[model samples]
Target: MISGIGNIYADEALWRARLHGTRPTETLRRAEVAAILDGAREVMTQALGEGGTSFDALYVNVNGESGYFDRALYVYGREGLPCARCGSPIRREEFMNRSSFSCPRCQPVPRRARP
Candidate 1:
């Protein structure tokens, strides 16, 4: 399940790869999976370079500093905002007790059930 991935990075990577979170792994081509992994790596590398994502005061660095990467995010926590790739608004869905964000135009809902 895509729930194994954290909500924040998952949304960002999905947007980068133009994939829907509910996409079944069995339905994905090897190249698509690779691209998604690459997207995740790229975003994570960028996040690490900028410290990390800190949503609140409780999540602070060793120096008690909040990360600045939140401002650089494209999809996560950007509900109702325009997508960078498509002009569609980013939509948030409740999943596994948390939220999942995606561009409805870019990442369409899957019609087939996951294997």
Candidate 2:
């Protein structure tokens, strides 16, 4: 997935929430989610900007299990499942192997810590 694209999507969603006069709590929740996506995108851009170190072949420790280097996109695919950040059912995965997990009720983006 395009990092910039994902960030943009998140930002747009937050903006929509705010413009719609969503509940204060819900608005804050959206903002937090945007932050998480933005932060993740920033991390990706910074790491890949060098264009030397490929995200592939990198090993990520998920639940203490070291998953092999596949692609940076995989990080977000795990949607609609239990968010590693919060124990909430995540949205369904949009792309393969890129499950997105977040308890919109618990792990709204901004509240999530940097992974």
Candidate 3:
């Protein structure tokens, strides 16, 4: 298990890894988990370099400056938009009173067994 990952980074990393957000963690292969962690590190590094993501004026750094990483995001908060890696549309779903964004083509949801 990992730590220090917020919702935005998690979604962005999942998108980069091409893994569905709703997939069971126990079903993930070692390589897949590695890829997810790698994606997370890559995006987090980029976000840190840019001072992090800020969608509104409420989020400001010690200097009272907003982050610019939000513009560079691939899927976070980009519902119904074209995926950066593909022409397919990005999808958003309501999760625990929050939103999760991903590329439907890149990250296909796994079928669940019927009760």
Candidate 4:
């Protein structure tokens, strides 16, 4: 499940994979799932290299340095900004009490599963 991926990386991975976070896992093709996982791994690896994500003064590393990954983010915290891939504005929605960021044009809402 993609639940434990945290809001930041989840949004980043979804943007990188060009997949909507609302898409049901069971509805995804194996190749598509693989691509998403790969994208997540790639983004996490890059973030790790940059010392991870730091939102404010509360989040800091051992050396009390803030993470630089925030600067490299493409979607998270960029609501109303133009999407990197498409010119459409990035949108932020409330999900599970947290914010979910995505490009409406690039990552349209997945259709609901049939009953």
Candidate 5:
């Protein structure tokens, strides 16, 4: 089953799935979609396993507790850091009024989608 995820989860899932932010859903094969879903599940599973997650001190849980899951992140909020799978630095861009992060080398934009 697929559920909607926020920007943070979407970024993490895309990074895990090695999918470009500008990638068109229509161009994705079944396996790629599966990978993205799996990535999302993995993130949620890990967060649930740890009770919850907080990106910063301001992101406390309903119980007012901070979780360590933020440290396990692969791309979210990690701009300019080396990608886990590739040595390329993760880049951040303004997307839909929010930040989107990805490794340039790992998730290259399709030529048609490039500005």
Candidate 6:
């Protein structure tokens, strides 16, 4: 969800992509993300300009039923499974009935040194 300057929504990309096709290209998706971030930044600027407190925050609802989380998981998931872009396998895992997918070639998971 996104909110700022009296504007709020559960899904910014879903809203922006309404004008275009629901299935947007990666470039278009990136643009939509940028627009949302920019809008929030603009809200902060507006607040600062008015001498009000300006701040930014991020929030996620794991239990949200609006499909936002599912959409994100679908896009970022499918790991080890063939990538739609490069034909790589999309990988996935199940935890408490929740699933996660990602492509190692596209999104390599960072390794942490063992203590």
**Tens digits of lDDT, candidate 3, 33-58:** 99899999887777666755442322
Candidate 6 residues lying further than 4 Å off, grouped into runs, are 1-81, 95-97, 113-115
Candidate 4 at 65: error in angstroms? 8.7
Q: How many residue pairs clash per model?
A: 0, 15, 0, 0, 0, 18
- Model 3 misplaced stretches (Cα beyond 4 Å): 1-4, 52-67, 113-115
Give the TM-scores of the predictions, in the order they appear: 0.80, 0.31, 0.79, 0.83, 0.80, 0.30
Whole-model alpha-carbon lDDT for candidate 4: 0.78
lDDT per residue for candidate 5 within 1-115, as digits (tens), equals 2225777678888888888867777678899999999998887777666755443322444234345434667887789989989888999988767888888888887667433
Score candidate 1 by lDDT: 0.76
Which ten contiguous residues of candidate 6 have the minimum total lDDT?
15-24
Stronger candidate by TM-score (2 vs 6): 2
lDDT to native, each model: 0.76, 0.38, 0.76, 0.78, 0.74, 0.38
The prediction achieving the highest TM-score against the true structure is 4
**Top candidate by lDDT:** 4
Give the Cα error of residue 48 in candidate 4, in Å.
1.4
Higher-lDDT candidate of 3 and 4: 4
* Model 4: per-residue Cα lDDT over 36-114, one tens digit each: 8987898777777775444332234323444454466789879999998998999999987888999999899988965
lDDT of 1 by residue, 1-109 (tens): 4565666778888889889988888898888898889888877777677755443322343234445544657888789999888889999998667888899999999
Candidate 2 CA-lDDT value:
0.38
Error of 2 at 21 (Å): 14
Off by over 4 Å in 5: 1-3, 53-67, 113-115
Error of 6 at 22 (Å): 28
> Per-residue error at 39 for model 2, in Å?
1.1
Ranking by lDDT: 4, 1, 3, 5, 6, 2
